[model samples]
Target: MTDPLLTETREDEKTAAWWRQAAVYQIYPRSFADANGDGLGDIPGIVSRVDYLAQLGIDAVWLSPFYPSALADGGYDVADYRDVDPRLGTLEDFDAMVAALHERGIRVVVDIVPNHTSDLHEWFQEALAAGRGSDARERYIFRDGEGPDGAEPPTDWGAAFGGPAWERVEDGQWYLHSFATEQPDLNWDHPEVRADFLKTLRFWSDRGVDGFRIDVAHMLTKDLTEPLPSRAELELLDRSSGRHPLADRDEVHEIYAEWRKVFNEYDPPRTAVAEAWVETPERRAKYASAEGLGQAFNFDLLVADFDADQFLRIIADNLEQARATGSSTTWVLSNHDVTRHATRYGLAPLAGRPVKQGVEWVAAGGPEDELDRARGARRANAATLLLLGLPGSTYLYQGEELGLHEVAAISAEQRQDPSFFRGASFDGLGRDGCRVPLPWTASGSSFGFGADGAHLPQPAWFAEHAVDVEAADPSSTLSLYRDALRLRHLLQAEEALVWTDTGRADVLRFARPNGWEIVTNFGEEPFDLAADAANVVLSSLALDGQLLPGEATAWIAPA
Candidate 1:
């Protein structure tokens, strides 16, 4: 019904489109793959896994930061945004990796940490050495007068990792660092600072990158005049690095809008995924509007306690809040920065009891025990499916499809995270458990990541539940993930996902235009099919209608 030229244009648009109904896989590169025997993940290593990711049916792969760095903050505190970190690979290697992934129709989006830079970063060093009242000093937030006099910091805020937020730079001056001392905050108000950031963004965009995931986006601006944290906490925090205020000033949006303008200049258009963990709906909407960021990571699901009512409310609330902001929302389960959801939700261990399945799976001795394990797996599976079928975008962490759980035993010596180093105990050694290397093969020393064991060890469980082992077994969680992902993409709905008024908070029901009703039971008991329901389309459980542990089901027209 259309001319060939017009059809070709639409095809081209589809290929370049960055923000559509899609699923994204986040790869913490250092922990994703290691090609050479150097014990570190590299560009070639990531290239080798493109096919594996492609099979997962994701439209794009969002790689964590890979720029040149001092390995501080795991590459977030970049030294050179234009060059590749030697530990990862050369710039040429990165170009080749990009080419390889694009050849298979998968877009690439990398993280950009503009809020701060490594104190060792040339720019930061220049600013610091330039001393007070120098132009270079304006690039950072350096204060004058008698600094933190062994008392309280300049603000009553705790560092995200732990302790106080401000650190003394010299005898009479201090600098603001919300994270660590080695990482110094950039002054967003500085013209040169903004110019350098734009240059870095454009450099990557010009290289055919699909988009960027802005790191700690809300922390770009701070109130230097705020009061400091408790004296005791300040002393402890300073032992690591002084802290700074959190998410200060809405003026950050104005700065982001300017960057958005540059991003829009791309012929195919580009996206800026903001990392703002907005606590309120009104505040969240501002980052995803037409004049703001293209999309923002919605941590609403992350903070949920994994109850049926809470899950439903979070989804419904986000949908309402993001509707006016161009209806582009991102749903994420696990990331390099958070504990895996399955472990967090207690699905792996219910009521202080461990339910064993997958990798370390134990076949129950009795049918009753088997049913209980199946039921648990069904609930976990249902929640994941529910997320994929939701409106807007879905983000799947590297190992989530394998239903990976938290490592029960990680010694203090193995803990290398900035958070752990800063005395942050409960907030999880700063995502190190989830950031462990992916396990692709069960037999190999590196679990199929590389010839040698990766620099950071994969959890010990990988020996039991690697992808290669699961791929050979038809009943593995890896297989279920592939099935779910394929089904999600095969869905031929023109309209986006829409929720149904199922009334029961424990039961999440939604309908696609293709006559499919996806229902998930998050409760501890069975949910009978509603009178109007026809038949089961997809079940995360066994064929006996007994919802297995961590399983889910989708229903449609009866035969």
Candidate 2:
């Protein structure tokens, strides 16, 4: 395909607003690459890999949290938002990394965690020391107990990581923490708390960062005066429905609107992508409104199964919602939090049913256990093509290009996620499976991830999917990503997506305005594409003559 979209030299349109229709790569700093041989990936290590990212044809990089943290929630418990973690690198190193990325025409989007702060943070520490009813305590959500002697908690709210959301201080006051106890929720009702975050936003933006990925974007405001919902009601508050006391409230949008004002003050205007897990598409659209953050993650497709009907419905819903709000839709597959799609697609139950709820772990032995690694990989590749071919922006998680599978066998002693430790039933099975360090080379210590062993142990089978190993083979997953991403930039820039009825119920066929067609076969049987397809641009797997195999995707021009 020729560069049809680049024919117009609209220099005035070309500015820092490059996020629209961009392919952004998410980098989990601890697991990306280790330059200093310290077994942990750092900013300098990421700096070393800039050329690799440029070669992959990504427009931007969204880095996960790397602030000064206790690592209680894997850097989500941020102690200091202004500086880089000593383990990761210094602030100087962060500046160098950003400069290198910008030089390569890649934008940098850092993770901004405004919902909570580490208990070890100076403000949180002062709140604890200043005792109850003090000004310091006002920075966080601190409330007195309801019962006699203040023995009972304020309410029956539950934490996302597993226990009671309220933890009592030595002064007999309970503070709310929606996640881990080490991370106390910030009191957005306080003007000082809001000002501090505004300063934090400016601090990074002043350092030349292009944008931010707001963590827990829907979780800043809470009606602390209202009685907490019952445990049953809380359980009803999944990703899709039900209104909670603390999440997706109308007040949260006000905060983002203020942030948006600050974002616009910059040249070309810094953009923010919200990590809001709101219920309905309408509610999600509110977070991405003109006054709000401008982009919110549309996770409907991520929660869907590999079925054609479910995929089409989610895509249509997302695009419609984005259009309603005048914002671009954001598509994502795997991230640091969820189970990798490579493993999720292999589980037998997901083959027939839609994955509405988040997946934690798949049982090892069951009568209907149908965990096929090869099949899962094939589906993952197909799904990537489908995601990229869509009409808006896409986010790619680290190590996905190598087609890495979930390392579900990590032992109990090596496990680090707070979710695993908090829930009895979730023991030995947490997010550590997907957070394993990347394998750069096929051999050497930690698969060349570092000089020493990785922070999270790499599985023995990781060698098979190492970057050096895959780069040499043309048919490897890494090559597929390179080819797909390069072609995606050329073909998807100015195209409009129109769904096509392939007549087969199990097939999803969509056509683009640029004479490109995409067909994905989710059915058990092979799909004959000889009649509909002219020249094959790409295929997730080797096609049997002119037949697209089951669990595969093909890109072609119309016959």
Best by lDDT: 2
State the lDDT of candidate 1 residue by residue for 272-315, as single tens digits. Answer: 78888655666767777768776788987775655677776777
Model 2, range 1-559, lDDT digits (tens) per residue? Answer: 1111121213454475477688999999999999898888999999999999998989999999999999999999999999999999999999999999999999999999999999999999999999978999999999888888988888787788888989999989999999999999999999999999999999999999999999999889877665666767766765443245678888788888899999999998998999998778878888888698988998876666778889877877777776677677888988887767887677664445332212333422111245678887888999999888877789999999999988766676887899878872232366887899999998988998888989988888899999999999999999999999988865664525777767798998877777688889998799999765458879997888889999899988645
Q: What is the lDDT of residue 181 in candidate 1?
A: 69
What TM-score would each prediction reach against the true structure?
0.85, 0.93
Worst 10 residues of 1 by lDDT: 1-10
Write down the TM-score for model 2. 0.93
Q: In model 2, where is the ten-residue run with the lowest total lDDT?
A: 1-10
